[model samples]
Target: MRYLFLLFMLFTFQLNAQVVADDFEGFGTIYSWYGDDCIVDANFLNPYQQGINVSNTVLEYHDIGGQYANVQFDIDTTYDLTMNNSFSLNVYVPSSGLTGSEINQISLKLQDKNIEFPWMTQSEIVKPIVLDQWQTITFDFENDFYINLDSNSLPPIERTDFNRVVIQVNGENNDDEVLAYLDDVLYFDTVSNNPIYDNLVWFDEFDGNGPVDASKWFKQTQLIAGDSWANGELQHYTNRQDNSFLDNGSLKIVAKGETYNDQDVTKDYTSARLNSKFAFQYGRVEVRAKLPSIAGTWPAIWLLGKNINEDGGYWDAAGFGNTSWPLCGEIDIMEPNVAKNQILATWHWDNGSGYQINSNSVPSTNANTSQNWHIYTLEWSEDTMKIYMDDTLVNQMDSVNPFNQEYYILLNVAMGGSLGGDIQPGFNQDAMEIDYVRVYQETPLSVQHFEKNKVSFYPNPVQNKLHIDTHQFANTNTKVQITDLSGRIISKKQYAENGDTLIYNTSALNVGVYFMTLSFDNGINQTFKFIKQ
Candidate 1:
């Protein structure tokens, strides 16, 4: 009977995939929709959005009258929540979006269609959205499946047969003035609609190398032109084997405190900077590296516009002929401050007026960034740039400025600069070790396909439930288990040996970290760690 129920659930799930119920594309003017306390703001320009999409009319919530005042709207189409159970929408929250002393969180009221009156269940979003940016708010019904009711006369809210979506901005029973912007409401299946990026434009494992690959990478010495690398940097870059080398499938850039004179330019510290010969316009990049522990060591994995040769990565006796920096865009992927547990992503460009630097920094409150290996990622398209560390979104930005041009990769370590401050006198030598650097472009699948395409799960610090899907797991015994860090089993489930998709509920677990493992009959086991916050 358990297997039978699982089979039926999978069957029903496969039948109800995601279709665009309503995009709110032409909501007020061309199309018809009903909303209270909100109207289409046609003239207001949206500074941030997807690349292909322009600043269209967004449903704006004006001065939401008073405490508990809200702008409510409903999607009139019938949606089968059993399959397409996630409701996603984009909300623009200005710096002053949340006004007055109100406990954070907005309430989403979903109603089921009924003959007389629909059954309403309200869910509160406790996760606060970042301000002064456009954020896609996704509500997975399976995660926080709580139903807050004022009157208990109606039966429990049903999840399998829901057809309507009613949302109240700032509706967690809190009273306050709220102003917000809403757009692109969608219902989607988390697994079937999984996005993939498979094109491997460039990658360097740095394995079996004496010197860095000259065809793909070149060393940048500050003495190439003059050692005037900006930001009060204190490092003399060298292309010698003492500064950079590969061993055991890892590239190490050693930073030494005592440096000798070279080509009339001398510094107390010597390090290495390698710039890529390959330049790409738009793509996703992932770099796995363990950082240096010494104080005042600024290890960076970054990019610069190939056209801008100010730093002189590939300079000749004639020098690179380009305009200059600020005319050329710069994207800082991972720049971990010296001796700090924080990382920052910065964008520098000239906006036809003046130079601007927009940096988004995220700090680790628990541990130092130099403690272990981490995967730093940057997803860049035409107009959008998002950064992540170990799959946690550091921040996102939207702009089509000078960053629209092609940029090449750069890796280096600088000591005692603006961000890297206070070098310890006793510091001698430390190295930033890198495992691999992989660059991928938009495609139909993921780069993980290079590993035979194992099971995939997403939204890694999973909020409530973990969705797992495997394309090739055939008629074999399969069991997935969730366990704590101490190897204690929290929950386990045995699925039918044939299906490619399954789910594990983590809502009932504690608010700590846990591990999930998938066991197959072919003696293969895959385990991944996730947080249930």
Candidate 2:
């Protein structure tokens, strides 16, 4: 028994030590590939311009807006991707002209040639995508790949029989004929037990005195012109610090029961509502706030689309009803009804009926643990909203619907209204204390390359021709936009590619200081100042 255990340990170590590398360094010798509506040749390019021989020839997919284009690899032997825990890929996608729908529009799949058609494991491209430059996309097989089997009399596509690998563009993006490329596909066996997001794009620490950072937040103080801000809420939101202010290192939204007037209306309650100046469509949001324990207090951390058209014109001058409530979706991350001891996570949309909402309610905390600091989180991705309290998932909503669009964050406190309940006699002022609000965007691409190759643009104070040497293949994404010092775009030009050098003519330009921004397919943009004298 002791020798058996020792042998097993040795076998496990040997398995984990194995690594795979298929860089496609050779030209169709040991391994080969093919494309369908996609042309998979690195040598043949349309219109025939000089092409660069990148250290390595990547898998080129010339997708001409067809049903789809896929790359099938010739694996010498059966491949088992599940055996390895992680893999890395080099990919590029042009950022310009891409809609929110095209963000995660890349995917991977595999098939066992021994089985019939569709006998494969294809995963949804849930991974994040950055555009216009080269970036490494890492996949943790334990989470990114799997095979779902259905009823079949024949044996399913066993993991050991997956002899063909397919790389595809998730046929959803509206790209006319994008020239996509892939390089250095490598695999490893270490399973990562960490979160996918490692980048912080925006956040509010709520630190110091005075008003909140104007660059990060904006307070909403106006009442809806003809109507109050929906719900029978009694709070007259104000822009004053008395209602919303920074106390110590936290934010305080005080709900007071007193007569106050704002925007041609009077109310018996006054509070504050703040909106983030920036809007985001997807990411992780975490807010640590202490709810008001006062019987009449209601606090909420939520979001709403920025375009909630409320200018009285049903349409734009000509009258067509552009947009309004519900069409502009609302996401209520957490609304703690102190009086009811329940937390509500509701999603509201407009299907022509003022509002249509789906909600879930859960105990804010254990009876004894009430009125304490709790971490409320909203893990929002492309099409899902997962609400959590202190790390426990309380509610989840599917269907992206309105959430697929960009929306801004809002924090507010209300008193003695619909959900706030009856106010106790002599209700003074109670506050919702917020430790911090942090927003993290999806990033952390797979194993990245640290090559120091510089993509140069020259003719600093040019009069006519400008030259650029991009060590990458020149696709439709290779272009430059020249903007004036005042930030107005002067002209945008596509480069004439010849090997690794791209030539742009700036001969017809006014003489002045200008900025030239070079954009690529893999989320890379380089800007340089130039003089057009």
Candidate 3:
């Protein structure tokens, strides 16, 4: 019976095995498999069909929005296509200049017999197409599939049925100019429907034997007297090798108590700060580094906005009175004060009510961070922002609003801030060494199915407290039983409600290994292993 049930579930998955549309061999011909099904429709636009003209640049093909035509096609399959499926094609554009609102460029739509405006997220305007290039464009239709001027806000399982797929050449673009060319169109199964962080973006591991990649990083070279640039912060910015160096396979940002002045203070300490030349919207950002030691010194790895105050430009804004700093928004991924060896994850935003800080902190036992390296991370997304020390989720943003716009990562050592005022008078030089920084997006896991099974918790290596997040299975009648490793029941408790979140007070339990079992009404059994220190 168990094997039969598993088979039924797998069959119900409905794996996508059909190609909804395609024009391989560079638009030379359209062939259908399973015999004698060669067909063409007037609604589909094929530039190579001699009805439209396209120009090729050194990079890819190009066409004006209003001037070009649209593309369309219909498959024998109806609108029942749902999650785990995808639509894909390749497009090559030369120019990197385009407006964000131009819908005539690219669009995908699904409609009933009416074809009225549907809810979906259309493609944003991008740079003009380059010449003689191949740009592969894959559209994941599994996640509520979107179309031009429409937003897909439906759940995955709810929006799987549709009747049409429409691609267009013009939208919100006044310049009805030339038409764009396309080729090699195919749709298949996708692991997930997320477009931005689907685990295929390009990135470097920073493990080479030389300097950091010049194409990815840009160094800041500025020395303002008092080195004050908001946060009422202290420390002079320098480009010296001693202050910041890439040696023995790591990047170092050093802070010291020496000074020089161009028009301000001439004597103090110096350090280096590095910023990326590129900007990222959302991803998992991780930094592995060793903190520096100095009484008043502060070391940090964080991110900043790209265009907070863009009128004066990038370099000028870091010089004070040029642009209001934190007002634009700040994501402090990791900040360790000299007074403590621990790291904190926090967010600062203006809510019509000045800048407020929301943060999470944890203890450090690695002997004054300056001695060994630790991995600090900031997991950012449209709905959540989190901080992690190594593998532990230390602090998370309370409201999930800190990451709505574009933000660039930063790794620097500041002498003082609102928290760094404790910098002692007799301070010399110190350094923060970083192995590398990496970013990623989490794979979406199925929560609905995971909650249907029995849940259990186990004995743990603990000296303080143990809690179970029973809220996961809120609709089932469940009971938890705790026992010694030798099959001795210590306690049995029932929840008031299905998922009434219960806490097992460990105040009286002795420090030792134990076992826990959870039995569900469906006859499913679950167990876990834990420890008590």
TM-score winner:
1
Model 2 misplacement above 4 A: 1-195, 225-227, 310-322, 351-355, 367-370, 444-533
State every prediction's TM-score relative to the real structure.
0.53, 0.47, 0.44
User: lDDT for every model?
Assistant: 0.64, 0.61, 0.52
What digit string (tens of lDDT, one per residue) describes model 3 on residues 271-353? Answer: 76777655677777778888876666677788777755533324335442233455657888778654665677777777555
Judge candidate 1 at residue 527 and give its lDDT.
Answer: 58
State the local distance difference test value for candidate 1: 0.64
Residue 270 lDDT in candidate 3 = 71
The ten-residue window of minimal lDDT in model 1 covers: 3-12
C-alpha lDDT (0 to 100) for residue 408 of candidate 3: 71
Better of 1 and 3 by lDDT: 1
The parts of candidate 3 lying over 4 Å away from their true place are 1-212, 223-227, 310-327, 366-368, 398-402, 441-533
The digit string of per-residue lDDT tens for model 1 on 303-325 reads 87777756445632125437477
Error of 1 at 33 (Å): 14
- Between 2 and 3, whose lDDT is larger? 2
Candidate 3: 10-residue stretch with minimal lDDT: 1-10
C-alpha root-mean-square deviation, candidate 1: 16.2
